[model samples]
Target: MSSTTSRRTNPVDIIVALIGAAMFGLVLYLRSIEVSWYPVLLLVAAYLVFAYLFFRRQGGFGGVANPKDFYTGIVLLAVCGVFAAGMFDLPLGRVARPGVAFFPLMLLVLLFIFAVAILLSGLRNRGEALGPVPWRGLFIITGITVFFGATIKGLGFVPAIFVTGFVSCLASQKWTALSATTTAIVLTIFSWLIFIWGLGLPIALCGSWLRTALVALGVAGESIPFCY
Candidate 1:
């Protein structure tokens, strides 16, 4: 491929690829870290950055936003920060299984309340203007992420990629078996090399029990005993 042939692709494509590379790299770096809250922080930051980028790409942040989105985001940020802090701080007696779970629950509640408030306020204010959400794209993206997160460890990269990409393509109404299969394989290889070899992150490529054992050992070996 000539340099001019490569240059035919837009800068946006390059930027997006770099973002994905950085994110995957960060995930590996994060896995190596001792802190539990780093994932939460990374997730929150990713959401914020993506949200801002989406709005910017769409021209602006929705409509004449007085304090709805900003206020909700700020409140949720505080809630997420608190829960993240609690879950990560071992001496605080907050366990991950339950403590980390509350943040999503809180988010659901906040989302519900925010939606109701926005609806009522819009009704009272008479006129309202907001950009249409790309529901199809959002649903596909979310489904893919959930599928990957849930199945990555147990299924490893291959099956997880197939499942996630196929299901996501189905959700997005662009189901193509060949395309999905090819994409999944490519992604799995990319992820494996990047996570396992490039960054040295510990993800289970072995069987479930062995993986669990290894992870437990890793955690145990990495942990420092607390002294009162």
Candidate 2:
């Protein structure tokens, strides 16, 4: 087929796009009015019905051929399940008081709606091929974050920040060890000054044991702020 033919606008695509835009506008309107969860739930049900019709018009479940769409749908569904589970015990406070659950629940509802839309779109547009996953980049980033979280408390703010930055930089093919190390040091110091000293956040700069040792040796005083 000619490129022009392949690129021709599909009515299904236009309809889905219009519906998505309308849904987004409705979300904004609902936000302004501070509507209750019950109404939002009703809207979600209505959207699902619309989504079902859209999917059916596109050729039903058998039409979905792209792996990307398959994975995206799975991820969105997983997220929806997690948020729904979390909402079970969450308190829906009054409009004036609006408990912690209020914002999360709203977000959850929006996510569910969007997820369904994405899944349906994927099913409709099954002509596209899936791209390769960047496993190396993904693993490196995930590992660096995990390491930072695991070691931050024991290693102190500066050290943890430095390590996180260095590792993250190394994840990219462009960064050399020396350049990454220098950048990491500069960033760690800069962040420490801003967030720890200036903002006076209550993060521990050093571990409890290290702080105790410093005090005993008279290198630092007990009254020194943990954050600094």
Candidate 3:
């Protein structure tokens, strides 16, 4: 039975995988010489299609009504879609002097591979009981992430981080507002110190409006660089 299942050929999977492999090769070639945005975008798109087809063929969501498989598959697909969309128009650098998107694109490819493994494992263990899905927690965390991304530019790094962290913590039933606030504040400060001050990262501590207000109040220098 196992052999028969393994021997079963899904033409869609084969075609998609072939296309993905071709795209991967092209990406590698482009990386070796001159990197461009379009080719990389194409590669990512091909990979996404391949992933969808492959997972769908592998008894989609691990044989229907399996919440664990469904959740895992959905999360992986969502992440891949987000990454591809975010990186689509970004420039890709050369092999010697790679651009900002190079490493991230590579990492995203690895993430796709990892997601495939997860899907395969889920398929193999389809018989196992997948407990109830935590819809509240999932939605809460996702909302917090979206909120952070949307508000970060306007609120600046510190405030955005604190708000997101506190709200995300509240997703857990055990956390209270006070505890979440304290933890969020401490974590935000720690991250600021570590990533900004100690590491000399160019993260903005305050937005333009806040900075202007502080300067006007004589609380900050007029020439406040966005990075603290």
Candidate 4:
């Protein structure tokens, strides 16, 4: 706590923080500032949680003694619950025309199964120690998703997708800066075409953040859609 030498990577704490962040993000995605007063409170709460988790008195490998599968299953179950809770907001259209929740709900089904099995395996002592977690990979992937979900309203679809893509590429073992940039660019363009032009979704190409900056610069800010 007092010295760098006293600090160590605490993946469990990190992962729990990540999950909390992810849930906060999910709340944003579901509401997107539609609700008043509470989101700010939630943001402040999330900050407190991360601060406590990251800055609390430190130790080596701060996780449970259970096998990796156990905690992994537990986390997955938590994730499933988060998604399942939100599934009600999304329309569950018929099989011919699936709603936004359809795919995620289906995946949650599979995840529930896998989470249970892995958790059982962990209880059975069939897996290795929960140490040496792929914390970096998990952090990169989940962290980016959480960031995207939390910022999508402010960043909008294209920017959110691009940022998520770039950060996600960094998680890959064979990623280069050029490659990541190119991929993000291509992804942004394709998404803009699909979600903007093709689907005609209400998502803004340039979100409120850019719109506000453009407004400050006296650059066609009044014409911006979804900047409200």
- Best TM-score among the predictions, by candidate number: 2
Ranked by TM-score from best down, the candidates are 2, 4, 3, 1
User: Could you say which candidate leads in lDDT?
Assistant: 2
Clash numbers, per candidate: 0, 0, 0, 0
TM-score of 1: 0.36
Candidate scoring better on TM-score of 1 and 3: 3
Better of 2 and 4 by TM-score: 2
Off by over 4 Å in 4: 1-127, 224-228
lDDT by residue (107-204, candidate 3, tens digit) is: 77656655554444445443335557788799999999999888777678888888888888988979987999899999898988898789987668
lDDT of 1 by residue, 41-101 (tens): 5654574466446435745434434343334445655664575455444431133333444
> Candidates' TM-scores?
0.36, 0.54, 0.43, 0.45
lDDT of 2: 0.71
Ranking by lDDT: 2, 3, 4, 1
Q: Per-residue lDDT for 1-228 in model 4, tens only? A: 233321332354445445545554553354323433245346545654554444343332234334565687788989977977877677755445656765675565556555654543344333345346677789999999899988888877877999998999998888999999999999988987887789988887768887788888998648876565
- Assess the local accuracy of residue 203 in candidate 3 as a C-alpha lDDT between 0 and 100: 62
RMSD of 1: 19.6
Over 10-65, each residue of candidate 2 has an lDDT whose tens digit, in order, gives 57655764675476456445544554566666666777788787777667876565
> Which regions in candidate 3 have their CA more than 4 angstroms from the true location?
1-129, 209-228
Residue pairs whose backbone atoms clash in candidate 2: none
Which residues of candidate 1, in runs, are more than 4 Å off? 1-121, 129-136, 206-228
